[model samples]
Structure formats: structure tokens, C-alpha cells
Target chain A: MKVVVQEALFDPWEEVRNYQQQNLPRGKHGGSVIFVGTMRDFNEGVDGISRMYLDHYPGMTEKHIERVCEDAMNEWDIMDAYVVHRVGEINPDEPIVLVAVWSRHRAMAFDACRFIINDLKHRAPFWKREQRPEGEHWVEGNTADERAARIAS
Target chain B: MKVSVKYFANMRDRMGRADETVELDEGATVASLWAKVSDEPMPENTLIAVNMEYTNTEEALKDGDEVAFFPPVTGG
Candidate 1:
């Protein structure tokens, strides 16, 4: 299990390769599921998002992510899970976060990956502010009701 | 008692500082601490954490605790 929080951009494919090389020798992982979250040029129908600034409570961010991944691992039959989130200023089209899970079967891998991403979205401590041509604005968060509705759908 | 209060994102911008130490009565809760710090109304959906854990406004605070307040998380 590994959780990383940094200001530098990371290569998702390289991260996966590194994880496989480091952990495959220890245990057998038949399948791997990965999710890469990227910054977009628009949000909530607004356009021209040139840059995004991500801020996190340093010590707490990593701990929260680790806890989320740990919960997923405990609930599912998975070998390992990894999460990496970027802080500082990021441009559109750059990756923001990555979540990967390894399991003996495809089913567990898929479910665990999804669970980690969803939980991270709702539970993590990172905040985002968007910079655009008009002005900079802090993006509002998804309310619990909205999250519940999304999960139900 | 004293608690280290930290602000992030817009909270920091609005407060014009990243962190500070505030004196409080013994056993003050997050809600009262927030009231003591900012004069304006707390933003809707604001999130609070105590000692690196997600906590509620009613949670009792301890001396030397690190309290963080910020807007709701918007990250993926």
C-alpha cells in the first residue's frame, strides 16, 4: 500500500509500472485497475479555465488518502492499492490524481478502484481554485445530498 | 489554553493569513473557536478538522491541538 501527495506532475503509466515491479515479486496480482483524474478546461458550464490551484492540509492529506485506500482494501479482496494526488498550480489537461488497485480477480480490482476514487472525492482534504480569463474562483464542493444522489444513480 | 488554527484555500485568502495561534478557554469546541476567529458568517459547507482528522464543530478541542478550517474539498 502506498499513498503519495506531491506538487509535481506524475506519469500515470510510469507509476503503474513502478508499482508492478516493486510489488509483483512479493505476491501474485492477476489484475490491476487504474483511474486517472485530469484537470479540465471547463467546470460547471464555465469555460476558459487556464489554471487550477490545489491546496491541501499537508499532514492530513496523506493520512486521509491512506485511510481511504486502507478501507477499500479491507472491504475487498485486493492485494494492494496506490493513490497519488497532485498539489500546487496545475494546468488544464494535466493529470490531477491517480488511483490503482491490484487484485487476484478483475471483479475485486474494479470494485476496489471505484471505491477508492469515490471515497477520495468525498473524504479527501484537498481544495481547488480555478483561474480563468474573467477571474479566479474557488470551486464549490459537492454536497452530501448530491453525492448520495450520484451513488444511487 | 492555546490551539494552533490553520486556514487553507479561500479561508486563508479571506483571513489573509495561513495560520495562527489563538487563546481559548479550556475545552472549547470547534464552533466556538471559529466564532472567535472570523467576524463574518461561516461559509456554507465549510469543513473542519482536528489534529489531522475530520471532525465536527461540536468536537471538544484540546490544548496544543491543530485545528484546520477550509472550504469543502473539491479534488478528485
Candidate 2:
């Protein structure tokens, strides 16, 4: 399992390809599931969001994401999981996060990938402040993920 | 006893600062520490992390502990 918190823009496909080439064994994994979350042009019923400032608790944010990835590996039969999340200022259509899971079977890969992304969405120690046309506002909350909520409860 | 308190996002904005060291009575819990710092009651869905681990207001505080307060997470 690997987790990276960075400020620079990343190519999701390149990250997946490189990680699989360097880390995964030959022919050992049968499937890989990848999920990329990107910044939207609009949010919370607002339009033309010019930019977003992503703030995080330096040490705690990285640790929280690492724990999320570890939890996913523990709950599923996945070979490996790599997560990369961007921090600091971001523009619309930029990738916010990447989650890739490799497993011997597709079912495990799918389950673990979803689990990691959902956990990051609801639990990670990152906050968003959007610069809309009106003014800057802190995002009150994330889009509700019932799966994450169920797991939390 | 004394503890370091850190605020993030909206909490930081509302508090008008990032972090500060606050003195607390011995055996003070997270709830009382928050009450000492802010006048408003803890907002709904507020998140608390003690020493970087998620915890509740009822969790007890200790000298040199790091406590963080922020709104609900909104990240991918």
C-alpha cells in the first residue's frame, strides 16, 4: 500500500502505469481498478467556480489516508493499492485524487477501490474552500456517501 | 496543564488564527477545552482530532497533547 499527498498536478494514468510496472509482479494480478476524482467547474448549486484551495493538516492528512488504504487492504483480498491526492490550490477539471487497486480477481479489486475512495471522501482530514463568483466559501461538507456512512455507523 | 490547540479551514477562519497553546485544568476533557477556547457550542458535524487520531469531545486531554478542531471533511 502507498499513499501520497502532493501539490503538483499529476497524470492519473501515468501514475497507475508506473506503479504497476514497478511494484506488481508479472501475471500475478488479474485485475486493476482505478478511480480518479477531479475538480468540478461548479459545486453546491454554484456555477463558475474559478478555483479551490485545499487545506490539510500536514501530518494528520497523510496518516489518515494511509490508514484508509491499509483498511481497504485488510478488508479485501487485494494485492496492492496506491492512492495519490493533490493538496493546495487547484483549478477546475484538475484531478484531485487517484485510487488504484490490483487483485487476483476483479471483485476484490472493485470492492477495495470503492472502499478506499469512499473512505477518503468522507473521513480524510482535507477541507475545500471554493472561489465562486460571489465569494470564497468553505465547503460545508462532502457529497453524502451512504456506503461510507453505513460503515461509520 | 497545557495543550496545543490547532484549528483548520472554517474553524481557523472563525478563530482568526491557526494554532495556540491553551492552559487547561488537570483532567480536563476535550469538551471543556473547547468551551474554554470558543464561546459558541461545538457546531453540528464538527470533527475533533486529538493527537492526530479522531476522537470525541469526551476524550480526556493531557499535558502536551495536540487537539485539532475543524468542520466535516470535504475531500475526495
Candidate 3:
């Protein structure tokens, strides 16, 4: 599995291609599955969301993200996985994060990919600071997050 | 017991630096260190992480722990 924390912009399509290419050597057995998370324009019906600030609790965040990735690896017969999340500032239509999974079958890839995103949302030490027209708001974690994390506990 | 305080994104800009590793007393709690070191309101709203878990300043600490403070992450 490969996990990267960077401050550069990524083309979603390019990222998917890279993941597919990297694991293509195992194409005889594992089928590649890709998941891309993109930025949305609207926020609670509010207009003028020019950009979003990417901030994270560093030490805790990297560890938790890696843990979730490792769990995905162990639970499935996956060949490889990649998680790349961009931090700093991002504009609308930018790629926020990407998680790609590969396995011999689609089921394993799909389930494991979903689990990774869910776990990261719930357990990872990261928060969303959305910048909007009115002001900046600290996004709150949801019940689903708390629920997903209990699996680890 | 010293924990390095690092900030990312806008918090970095506000703090005028990216990373700050500070030394504290042998038995300083997160809350107490916050009051002693944090001079400005933490860029309006911020999140604190102790060790490798998202935590609050009320959480206690042990030696050799790394404390990080920053704004919430908006990345998907």
C-alpha cells in the first residue's frame, strides 16, 4: 500500500491511471478498483465557496490514516492500495483525496475501499475547515464516524 | 516533557510558522501547556492531536508525547 500526504494538486483521472498502472503487473490475478473524491461547489446551499483550507493534526492524522490502510490490506486479498490526500489550500473542482484498491475480485476491493474511507472519516485525526461566503466553519464529525471507529476499539 | 506543536494550512500562516517544538515541564497536561504557550486564540477554531489520536486539551499526557495543533481538515 502507498499513502502520501502532499501539498500539490492532482488530476483525478491521472491519479486513477497511475494506480492502475502501478498494480497492472498483477492484472493476471487482481482487478484494479479506483475511488476518487472530488470537490463540490455548493455548501449547505450557500454561495461563493471560493476555496477550502486543508488542515490536519499532523502526528495523529498520518498514523490513523496508515492504520486504516493497513487494516484494509489485512482484511482483503488485495494486491495494492493507494491513499493520497492533499493538504493546504484547495479551490473548487480540485481533487481532495483519492483511495484506490486492487484485489482478485471486485467485492473485496469495493468492501475494503469503503471501509478505508469510513474509518478515515471517523477515526483519523483530521477536521474540515470550510471557507464560505459568510465565514469559516469547523465541520463537525457525525454519528457514522463514531460508529465506524468502534470497530477498531 | 516537551511536545512539538506544529500547525498546517491557515493556522501556519496565523502562527507565522509551520512547526514549533516546545519543551514543557515533566508533568504538564495538555490544557496547562495550552494556556502557557498559546498566546493568541487558535485561529478561531482548531483541533488538537495528542500522540496519534484526535484529542482535546483536557486529555492528559505522558513524556515524549508529540502534540500538534491545527485547523480542521477539509480534504476529502
Candidate 4:
């Protein structure tokens, strides 16, 4: 398991490839599930967001994500998990996060990947301040996980 | 006793400082710590962490502990 919280921009594909090469043995894992979250140009009905500043509680943010990955490991029969998240200034279309899970089969990989990302969205100690054409504003809250909400009801 | 209190995101702006050392009575809970720091009522969505771990306002705070207050997390 690996978790990285960085300010530098990263290539999600490269991260996935490197982690698999270094960690997962050849033919050891049959499938990998990867999820990448990117910044959108519009939010909260505001369009043409030029940039975004992500503020994170440094030590706490890492710890929280690590716990999420650890929980995924415990809950699923996955071989390993890798998570990379970007902090600091970001532009539209830039990848903000990457969550990859490897398992002997695709089912566990898919479920664990979704679980990790969903948990991170809700629990991580990170805040976003977007620079829109109108002005800057702190994002008030995250949108509900529609599928999860429906399932829980 | 004193605890170091940190604010993040909007809370930092609202508090007008990133961090501050706050005085508190022995066995003071997080709620009382907030009472000493700010005049505004704590928002219902306020999130708190004690010593870097998520906790409630009623969690007992110790001397030299680190407390953080922030709005609801909005990250992905």
C-alpha cells in the first residue's frame, strides 16, 4: 500500500504503471482498478473557473487517506492499493486524485477502489477554494454519492 | 492548561488567523475551547480534530494538545 499527498502535478497513468512494476509481481494480479478525479471548469453554477487552490491540513490529510487505504485493505481481498492526491494550485482538467487497487480478480479491485475514493471524498481534511470569473469562493460541501445514498435508503 | 488551536480553510479566514495558542481549564472539552476563542456560535457543520484525529466538540482536551476547526470537508 502507498499513499502520496503532493503539490506537484502528476500523471496518473505513470503512477499506476510504476506502482504495478515495482510492487505487483508478473501474473500475480489479474486486474487493477483505477479512478482519477479531475478538476472541472464549472462548479456551483459558476462557469469558467480559471484555477483552484486546495488547502489541506498537512499531517492530518495524509493520516486520513492512509486510514482509508488501510480500511480498504481490511475490507477487501486486494493485493495492494495506491493513492495519489494533489494539493495546492490546480487548473481545470488537471487530475486531482488517483486511486488504484489490485486484486486476483476484478470484482474486489473495483469495489475497493470505489470505496476508497468515496471515503476519501467525505473524510479527507482538504478544502477547495476556486477562482471563478466572478470571484473566489470556498466550496461549501460535496455532492452526495448518488448511488450510495440510494442504496442506503 | 493551554492548547494550540489551528484553523483551516474558511475557518482560518473567519478566525482571522491560521493558528493560536488558547488557554483552557483542566479537562476542558473542545466546546469550551471554542467558547474561549470566538464569539460566533459554532456552525452545526463544523468539523473538529484533536491531536490530528477527528473528534467531537465534547472530547476532553489536554494541555499541549492540537485542536483544529474547519467546515465540512469538500474534497475528492
Question: What's each prediction's TM-score?
Answer: 0.93, 0.95, 0.72, 0.98
DockQ of each: 0.80, 0.87, 0.32, 0.91
Give the alpha carbon lDDT tens digit for every residue of A24-128 in model 4.
Answer: 989999889999999999997889999999999999999999998999999999999999999999999999999999999999999999999998989999999
In DockQ, how does model 3 score against the reference complex? 0.32
**1 against 2, candidate with superior TM-score:** 2
DockQ versus reference, model 4: 0.91
What docking grade does candidate 1 earn?
medium
| Residue-pair clashes per candidate | 0, 0, 3, 0
Query: Which of 2 and 4 is the better model by DockQ?
Result: 4
Cα lDDT of model 1 by residue, A33-132, tens digit:
9999999999878889999998888989899988888888899999999888999999999999999999998999998898888778887888898997
Clashing pairs in model 4? none
What's the candidate order when arranged by decreasing TM-score?
4, 2, 1, 3
**lDDT per residue, candidate 1, B2-73, as tens digits?**
999999988899899999999999979999998999998788778889999888899999899999988878
Worst 10 residues of 2 chain B by lDDT: B38-47
Give the candidates in order of lDDT, highest first.
4, 2, 1, 3
Candidate 2's displacement at residue B74, Å, is: 0.3
Model 2: per-residue Cα lDDT at residue A24: 97
lDDT of each: 0.88, 0.93, 0.72, 0.94
Native A-B contact fraction in model 3 = 0.31
List candidate 2 stretches off by more than 4 Å: A146-153
Tens-digit lDDT string for candidate 2 (B1-76): 9999999999999899999999999999999998999999898788999999999999999999999999999899
By summed lDDT, which 10 consecutive residues of candidate 2 chain A come out lowest? A140-149
